[model samples]
Target: MSQLGKFITIILATSTLALTGCASKNKKSQVMVAPLGVGHGGNMGGYYGGPLVNNSDAIRNAARNIQGVVYFDFDSDAIKPEAARILDQQAQFLNSNQGARVQVAGHTDERGTREYNMSLGERRAAAVRSYLAGKGVNTANIEIISFGEEQPAATGSNEAAWSKNRRAELSY
Candidate 1:
């Protein structure tokens, strides 16, 4: 291209960024991640680091469709036996990639108050975290967050939707 064309392209890009406050066009897929300490069942509430979650396209693509999600029953935080297989897979993936980190997001159906749902979400996330830890994944590479009822997986107030909503998603 000519210099004039290159100049115009740069100008347009700068104008768009200035108007939009420098936001990227990509969609964000996970929550903020804090690093954890390198130990299990510690005195630090079992958590161990950070202000943000930084992910590369390579890591994200590698973890894509790895079936790292575990669902839960309505109003329950217990890890069901059927979920063990996928949880073990997730743990193995993480253990193999020592530098890779994953975020565990807990979600609940809109069947209870916001406060109650939030607590349930936390429990669900913790349960998943514990399971991963037991499977030999480093606790330091796992971060947890609770989305509660705010981010339902499915719309509507039906059994199908509720069942889909009660899940914990692992994002790397």
Candidate 2:
């Protein structure tokens, strides 16, 4: 090879060796990240310097204890007295964890038309967002979605099921 060709070849060889050496020696140590679910994506959780643990079960269990649910009255988006207390606790949580985000999902009973129920659900979610904002929680961190009557807490046409259905759920 000519002088220039030999220099280029040497550079390429060095780069290949350096890159290969930098590769992880243990194939088993490689981490495979699962695809993110629906919403504004990217690693919103930020970086964790520590080793990752598969604590999904723990998270699922602890989620039940987190009181982020608020019930509403029939055909009303207004925050009920009982719901206000629940919201207050949620507000406290959000206030303490400023970086935490929440998804407010509104649900309605199977009574009104799909369109009407969807609108009502949106209003319910908006009301919850407003209440949280009032309680010093950052509105920017809150996202609202209306599921309407599609996903009912209790499947029935009776008042008992209807009452359970009308609510907004907050998920972090």
Candidate 3:
């Protein structure tokens, strides 16, 4: 073959290879391939997978205004009197942020059976949800999830830990 023809062939091959490489790289970056039994369509065990809950600026501001999570007594599902003020603030925020939805996660200390704790956690979440609904927040926008004793705000088995665990977390 002529030198010019050979060079042209080489250039064409290299250009083709480069273009293929670029396409592959673009696909790699843009397309996320989840492993088997993962992603949105797959069953991620018992847990639901979706967007991470992020508190809106309004919700965060409201939470900050209220101070912090309210505590409940051991094995109780009732929201304490002190928590009413915080719930009131949260209710106001929910009422104002009509487009936002919230999830109330209930947790408990590692002191009871997993099943019992799960029930307790659910009750705790229900208590919070009921309070918010009573305060004029729409029930449709609020969800409840019970973590039971699986998740703990404080790890210790002491009073402080138990106190922190026996509460509901508001997420949006």
Candidate 4:
């Protein structure tokens, strides 16, 4: 065979293999060149193997990737941008897991009177709950509790402890 012909055949084989990699993983391959609506024809095709995977599985995976806790600045109940994005991911999972319910417990550093600290804690928890709700998670699926200064994540009299204590914990 001529050298140019052999090169053309080699190139065509390489192109075929590369394009094959782009095709869906389904073993039933006829759907590749099938027309639009003809893609899912019973015997001829399957959108995704045997059965549809549970969407909740994806949601659970997303939930697992995110830390369920959100921290706040000193004496602040505002959800920071970074915190908001994590909460958004949590909200997506919560919305997907229809049977899932969670508790958002608010905590505060030991600086204010019990009454004041309790109020602050509640505000923090409520702030997280409200954010999740705004992101489309059912508010009814979330329960809010205020721990005030009772539950300190890190115990100390310093800013590190204060920062650690001032946060909301999401528990399943």
Whichever of 3 and 4 has more lDDT, that candidate is 4
Among these predictions, the greatest lDDT belongs to 1
**Higher-TM-score candidate of 1 and 3:** 1
Give per-model TM-scores.
0.68, 0.64, 0.65, 0.63
- For each candidate in the order shown, give its overall lDDT on alpha carbons: 0.77, 0.74, 0.72, 0.73
lDDT by residue for model 4 (4-90), tens? 999999999999998788655755311111111223334221123322123345555555666888999988999998889889878
For residue 158, model 3's alpha carbon misses the true position, in angstroms, by: 1.7
TM-score, candidate 1, is 0.68
**After TM-score superposition, what is the CA distance of residue 51 in candidate 3 from its true location, in Å?**
4.1
Rank order by TM-score, top first? 1, 3, 2, 4
Per-residue lDDT value at 114 in model 1: 74
- Residue 81, model 2: lDDT of 92
What would you estimate as the lDDT of candidate 1? 0.77
Task: Estimate the Cα RMSD of every predicted model relative to the unseen true structure.
Answer: 16.3, 14.3, 15.3, 20.9
**What's the distance in Å from true for residue 62, model 1?**
1.4
Clashing residue pairs in candidate 2 (N, C-alpha, C atoms within 3 angstroms): none
Query: Which of the two candidates, 2 or 4, achieves a greater lDDT against the reference?
Result: 2
User: Which ranking of candidates, highest lDDT first?
Assistant: 1, 2, 4, 3
Q: CA shift at 137, candidate 1, in angstroms?
A: 1.2
